[model samples]
Target: MTTLTPAFFAQFDQDRLTAADQAHYMHGYHVFDEHREQGALNIAAAEGAYIYDTAGNRYLDAVGGMWCTNIGLGREEMAQAIADQVRQLAYSNPFSDMANVTAIELCEKLASLAPGDLDHVFLTTGGSTAVDTAYRLIQFYQNSRGKPAKKHVIARHGAYHGSTYLTMSIGNKAADRAPEFDFLRDKIHHVSCPHPYRAPEGMSEADFLDFLVAEFEDKILSLGAERVAAFFAEPIMGSGGVIIPPRGYHKRMWEVCQLHDVLYVSDEVVTSFGRLGKFFASEELFGVQPDIITTAKGLTSGYLPLGACIFSERIWQVIGEPGKGRCFTHGFTYSGHPVSCASALKNIEIIERENLLAHVEDVGAYLEQRLQTLAGLPLVGDVRCQRLMACVEFVADKRSKALFPEALNIGEKIHRRAQAKGLLVRPIVHLNVMSPALTITHAQVDEIVETLRSCILETAAELQRSGQYAGH
Candidate 1:
């Protein structure tokens, strides 16, 4: 409704193009009715930490292009690398004994970088496929190990793995539920989310930690350890409100998985590639070396569609065993596509050569600190974050920490307000999630925080004027 007149859109008949878009191109996870009425922002271009809408609006992309774009945008080097690979070999059949150099090199680098002995890499199209592949690999491994009954998988209630059928089943997020879509509920189970802030009213952090671990173990037992095959988790629960679980939660859960002989799959689609100032947060921040790590997004820095399912030596010894005549018949056609592998290699090169990880370590802490200063604001109930990844949960009553009614669309209100003032954040229910580029400077972090502060304040004023909020 702001009206778009971007240079690119000018070349075409704007009304006709807009009509074409509305008639076709159904978007993902979008409300079609609302979209048809409000239209869309044509993100024309991007550079560094900011994106330009067709309406000539430049906003700092605090969502980091949906939790990817680690090395930031419009990198000529990335473009060159991808183009070079395309001219050389665009597609590589990964079936049978066929191989490609780029993918092979990528595998070697990934193995060297991955924690522990997670050396085997199964490349896929995106995070969903990568996680789906991991699930299938778990099924194949458990069955090959003669434990055909171990088909059950355990995941946390708020955790998000992916959108694929198998990954959706493992992910117990609100969107991945029954009625709307069928899932493998009989084979997959969920325990409570390990969010400290949302723990029972009287439960202390220590008590919450104990409860989570005990509940996890109890869930495994309830499913019968012999029937439980694996447990899936995101290190920081990215889509589930940027949740940083209680201290020592991952390690304790890993211990439980070890005791029950259940494999731990760390889904690092959003956490890896410098988002947390580490390649992977499983072992560095959480003290757990998972048997498998499903990663994408920043693997190629979102320059290309690529995902990898990293497997440990223990499982590979079973799945990759010689001459069993049992073909691990699960694979994707685009697995290890030469261009994606090349992009990932170059992305890793840029991350290392520029020392973006170290940069993130310094500036990420600064961003979190600046964001925490917003806790005094009227609508802010919680400012939970880890390094560059963050979430600001809003509430009608800060004292009681009571959420605004879902119909109020508090997150969307703040998001629109911020976008109008040159900032962008992902609206997840009642929270606004942020994951800026690793290249963002400390000054930019200050700008993001200050602009966001004004947005929240402005929205609170509007809501109060309308009698929707009783200020804290």
Candidate 2:
């Protein structure tokens, strides 16, 4: 009913975005309409470690946009690389003997960078596809080797592999899976999470590792080791609230897997591509080389969607059978998109040329040290972190190690408060997770920590007055 003036249209367009986006889009990992009702924080632009909303308000992005924007938002080099590729050849189907030069080069570069002889690469669109490919590859290898009964896979508790039915089924977090898509439940079994906070009291690191290994052995034995295909894990669990397992836990677990002749696959989707102060978190952190590694996110630095399932010669040779329709019989239409591969190659070049991995090692240590100071706070129970990724768990009583009830929404309060103060944070359960870009400066680290500290005080008072502070 209103006249369509230019100024009016601008404001109307901005205001109408909230309603329009809410009505059509069913956002991922979000409660959709419910969160939409709360008003989405629509990002307009971003650069370095900061993002500006449509309202022109700027915020320091600590969570790195679902933990994917590792190289930070809006890098000119990445943008140009994507543009150049789009001009030359934007799309290609790497199927039926057809391939793209960018894709081939990316595979070679990734092979050179990957730990050990993870020489072969099977590219995919994203993390879920990479995980699914790895699963299929495992099956293919086992079947080729005449282990027809080897169908079950072992996944660690509190891990997030992907959202696809198979990956979701094996993921440690059961809540991520849709209620109806529980078909793969029987094919996957979960082992104890290596997180120390959830670890039972009076258990040493040695005992914990032994307990987990024993559980893995028990589960495999119960299912018959011959039926077990592979053991899947994240070097450090990400969406499972940033849990870092005990030292040597993976080594011992790998030993058990080897004893059972089970293949090991590391889901380095979030932990690879130098995000964890190393090219691969599994080999760098746990000192265990996986037979297969699924990686994404930083592969293209989220500039373009690209993921890969890299495998050692053992698994590769078994699956690379010739003729008679012996192929793996799995692939996506956009499996090796030229543009995505171009972006990934350039991104990796930036990481290597800039020495970003070594920077993460130094800055990550500094961050861990600084972040640990939050532990002494009355509301903070423990700070679990390693190298650029961190989480602060809120407890009702630090001494007793009791968490605040979910109803309190302490993490949400802290997150919102931090966002208001120009710092972005994500809340999961009773913890605040920060996964800032690896390129963050020391000053930026200090600023992030300072803002978070202020947010805690502000949230505490607000929650206390509202009778939501669960601290007794």
Off by over 4 Å in 1: 1-14, 175-178
Q: Candidate 1 on 1-472: residue-level lDDT in tens?
A: 1233565545555466567778887877767887899776667678888887755678899999989989999988888898998999989798878989999999999999999999899988899998999898999999899999998999999888888777777888884464668887688889999998899999999999999999999999988999999999998999999999999999999999999999999999999989999988899989999999999999998989999999999999997788888787877888899999999999999999999989998999898889999999989999987899999999999877899988888998999888888999999879999998999999899988998899999999999999999998
Per-candidate TM vs. native?
A: 0.97, 0.95
Write the residue-wise lDDT of candidate 2 on 1-472 in tens digits: 2232444334535677887778776777777545766967887667888887766678998898777787877887788888999999988878878999999998998899888989999999999999999998888888898988998998987779988877887786744654655556678888888888877888887787788889889999999998999999988888888988877888888898989998889999989877788888788678898999999988887777889999998776676656636766789999989999998888888888899999999988888988887777668878987888899988777667887777777788788888888999888878899888889988988988888888877777776788766554
In TM-score terms, which candidate is top? Answer: 1
Candidate 1's TM-score reads: 0.97
Give candidate 1's whole-model lDDT.
Answer: 0.90
Candidate 1 local lDDT, residue 145: 92
Return the top candidate by lDDT.
Answer: 1
The window of 10 residues in a row where model 2 has the poorest summed lDDT is 1-10
